[model samples]
Every structure is written in structure tokens, then in C-alpha cells.
Target: MALRTLFADPMLRMLVAAVLLAALLPARGEARDTAQLVANAAVFLLFLLNGLRIARRDVLAGLANWRFLLPLILFVFGAMALLGLGLNALSEPLLPPAIALGFLYLGALPSTVQSATSYASLGGGNLALSVVSAALLNIVGVFVTVPVFLLLGGSGQGAVGSAVIAKILLLLVLPFVIGQALQTAAHSFTARYRHNIVWVDRMAIAIAVYVAFSGAVEQGIWTRVAPQAWAALLGLVAVMLLLAHGGAWLTGGMLGLPRADRVSFLFAGAQKSAAVGAPLATILFAPEAAGFIVVPLLLYHLIQLVVAAPLASRLAQHPAGDGDCTAPTTTATDRSAPPR
Candidate 1:
């Protein structure tokens, strides 16, 4: 039963399998180039599909929930960034500077679209607000994050940030817009086959993860950091997530938000975008250091999944009062499972 549950989530299994595959057969020589090409293509398709999956109704509804939306957005971009900078500063003497910088980058990223909204739905939250806020952040984050990184004195500063932004426009944003445009033409087909797209999304992300870990492996990523450093990174991420979630809950309470909106706020405000973060790290950071920088984001992504799944489940078990956005009649499923 334990093993069955462990393998229940296809995405989680794929993630673990990808890491192991990278460890055993890290890409080299010509294969590395091919892998890069595949990863890039996968990312483009992933975003495009994401675009197609989004609905205009969600955006309009999200606008209506501005009170909840605004605070969550501020938390994602502003508070998280500042908190990371401060933590990095305080821990500078103890941890590697790269790891510190990694935390900062992680904080600066936008909230995830699919995962945040999915978890929100699962937790009996305001799905419309969650989806809308998440979509808006990704769109804005493309422009905002790089400049913020520069302001924080991130390495490769202007030049690297510029390259990342350009790539974001061409690869990420454009495909998404194109997908959105094609949605109307493909509506019937997409509606029929929407469920299948989820696997494609999972596969694309898994491919990206494999290529990233392979690059890191080639750079001797495992050799560079000690076990103690790994533990420290984990602890720091846990604290940050806890603080972010607590703040979101408190902020929603102060604003007199409904239970559903508060649930949406917690997930949206606390979650970071691994989908964007992982690919962007490759372009922004040097090859040798990209893996280390990605460590925090990767770990945090997995940790959030583990932590959110149970909480969402628990939250769903409770009843919502008046004015609460009814959790979608269809349940949201966890795409990933924790390692056994």
C-alpha cells in the first residue's frame, strides 16, 4: 500500500526518475546539445498549452477579486524578495554566496499558475482568483523579475538579465499568446482532449528537469555542496514557506476575506514558479553555477507540493460559509507525490 501510494502521482514519480536518470546517465558531448534542444522545445510547448488552458472568464473574475488579488501579488513579488535578501544577508557568513543568491532569485519569481490554482481548487479556495492572479503574475513577472534581479545586484546583471528577458519574450510569452489565440480555433478539440494535455505538461516539465539535473551533474553539482549545506537549504525553505503562508492567512483575516479567498491567498502568495524559474536559471547563470542556484527553487517546489497536498485535503474537508467561492465541483488532483 505504501509503495502503491508512493507511485500514485505520475508527476512525482517522473521527477524522481528524472533525477535518477540524470545521476546514472548525465548527458555529454553531442547528446548534451540535443538534450538542450529538446528541453527548449518542451518548455515552449508547455507554456503554449498553459495559455490554451486559461479562460478569459477567470481573468475577469480575478479582477473582481482585486482586494484578495492585490495583496497576494504584493506578497509574491515584494515581500518574498525582501525577505530573501534579508535572509541571504544574515546567513552570508554561514552559507555559500551562490546559495544565498539562489534564495533571492527563488523569491523574485512569480507565483505558479497551474499548481497554485489547482491546489487552491483542492483546498476549497477561490479558483478564479487563484488562476487569474497566477496568470497575471507570470505575464508581469517576465518584465519585473529581471530588473529586480539587477537591482539586487545579481551576477551577469544587465547582460544576462537582458538575454533572459529576450528568451522569455520569444520562447515563453509569445508561445503562450499564440496558444491563447489558437484556443478559439481549437476549442472543440481541446475540450475533448484537455485531460491528455496534462500528461504532456508533466512530460515536458520532466524533460526540462532531466536536462537541468544533467547539466548540474556535469558541473559537479553534487561534489560542490556538503550534506550540512543541503540541510540548511531545506530548513530555510521550510521557514520561508511557513512565514509566507502565515502572513497570507493573517492578511486575509485582516481584510475580512472569505475562507475560500483566504485559501487562494495562502497558496498563491506562498508558491513560486518553478516552471519559469528552472529554464530561466540556465540562461541567466553560468553553467557551473546554474545547478546550485536552481537547488533552492527545485527543493522549494517539491516541498510546497508535499506540504500543500495535505493541507489542501484537510481544508477541503471543512465547510465554507456564505460568500465563499465554492470549490470547483470537480476535484483537483495532486500531480506529484513525495518520495517514499
Candidate 2:
């Protein structure tokens, strides 16, 4: 049926498997401590492996297109800041100042591989561009995103400190650099072990989810967050997702971007990267707040998968003779297909 198989993506499947493992066979008492370590290692290795898969050339090329990417990055940043301000003003206080701040965090998050490619493939956006864009977003987020979080993640934690920055450098940037260096040194090994390593990414995320959730659970974090807060958080998540998707679609038409590029923008721009955000949040925020900060990210992850899959399918099934998003942005390249 050419339908998207949830199991086709070994990482997604592994994540599902890990979640089921946690839910169905949750660690208890003495087993809980060891389980936590495994989960944390899993999360670390995920990014380590994600870095290993990217082609250095594509990341470099995406950098070359700064004219396109820079503006988009700025636009996202500005929109997030503005939304935070506006949402902060609501007298209902449905949105605490922290939420507005959290929105900015989610807004500043890096892009993902699967969803971006899937949607770029849908609307005929640039595959190479999508690849590069996603990579650059992740790379930049490692440095700037966390520092910004420290500076602006609000008083829930004071200004993000230099030591905090150092941790990010250690955990994320340093390991990613080491991974890239290793990949360059052992291209053939990486290629050979790619399938085995794919599971690493999923296991990593599940480990992250468990560790983050567990830490919060241990501290009785949910009891602190009101039921109304959960409702508000869900509402805010919905509005932001709608805005991201709708805004991307509208901008594609208004900017007159080629259909393929629009697809790239829609998928790449709209979705938040949990793989990147989870590790960063755990390291930066208070253990109790990690759950709150990460709730949006996790929601964003699920939403992207649920929303984008069908959305891509519908876009792909465009009616005959309809004006296609097949137009090229630079050369005659077909952005919809995998780059030849």
C-alpha cells in the first residue's frame, strides 16, 4: 500500500519499544537506579549517532545558503519572543511567565531528520536543503540555544550561568564533535554499523524520557503542577503547533517559495526536535522543571509524527493536473525525490 509503516523507522520503532518497556515493565525500587543509568546513556548515544549519520558535505552546503536560512531562523526567534510577550499578558494567567519562556525554548529548538525529509518529500521541497537545514539547526542549537535558555528561560532559574554553558559544551558540542571526527576517520565503519547504530538513537530518546520523567516523579513534580496548568500547557501546545504549520503554509505562498521548499519549510520549520531539546533541558533546568520544560518538547514530537504523516500523505496525493510544488529553487533539481 506504500503506507508509512511505523516499524519502518527502526528508531521510531525502538522508541515505541522502549516506551512500552517502561510502561509495561517499569523499573521499581533497587532496579530503578540501574534502569535510570541505562536510559541516560541511551539518550546520550542517540545524538552521538545522529551526528554520525549526517554527510559533512551537506551540512557545509547548508551553511553556504545562509541567505535563506538566516532569515528563517531570525523569523522563528522573533516570533517566539513576541508570542511569549503576548501570552504573558493574558490576565487569566493561563500562561505563566515560565510558559511564555518555555514557548521560546521550544521555538528555539533544533529540527529533526525524519519529519523534515518526510514532508520535504511530500511538497517537493529541497531534499539537500532539508538535510542541510536540519543539520545546521541542530548544530547551532547546541551552542546558541542553551545559552539563550540560560539568559531567557526566565527566573524559574536565574540567568543561565557560565558553568551551565560549560556543561552544554561538554555534553552536547564536545561529544557531537568527537562523533563527527570519528565518523570522518572511520567512514566505512560508520557505513557498516549504520543499522546497529540506528537503534542507539531511539534507545537514547527513551532513556532520556525515562530519566527526565523519573527525576520529576521522584520529586513529586506532578503534584506541584496544577491540573489547570496541564490544561493550559496543552492548549498552548495546540496553538503553537497550529501557528507553526499554518504560518509555514501561508508563508510558502506569500514568499512564492517553490512548492518543494515550502514542504521543507513546513516540516522543518514547524516541528521541534526532542532529541536535541531533551538532553539540553535535563542539563540546564532544575530537575523538577525538566519535566515541565520537556512536556512541550515531547508533545511536539508526538504531534509532528501524528500530524505530519497524514498531512504528507494528503499532499502527496495531490490531484492530477494540479499545479505542483515541483518547481526548483536554484537549478533543475527535483526537490521532492532523494537527491541524485
Cα lDDT tens digits for candidate 2, 280-299: 76667655455455666666
Model 1: residues with Cα > 4 Å off, grouped in runs: 1-7, 156-161, 316-340
Off by over 4 Å in 2: 1-44, 81-92, 95-101, 153-155, 225-228, 319-340
Candidate 2 lands at a TM-score of 0.79
Top candidate on TM-score is 1
- Model 1 pairs whose backbones collide: none
Task: Judging by lDDT against the true structure, name the best candidate.
Answer: 1
Instruction: State the lDDT at 29 in candidate 2.
Output: 64
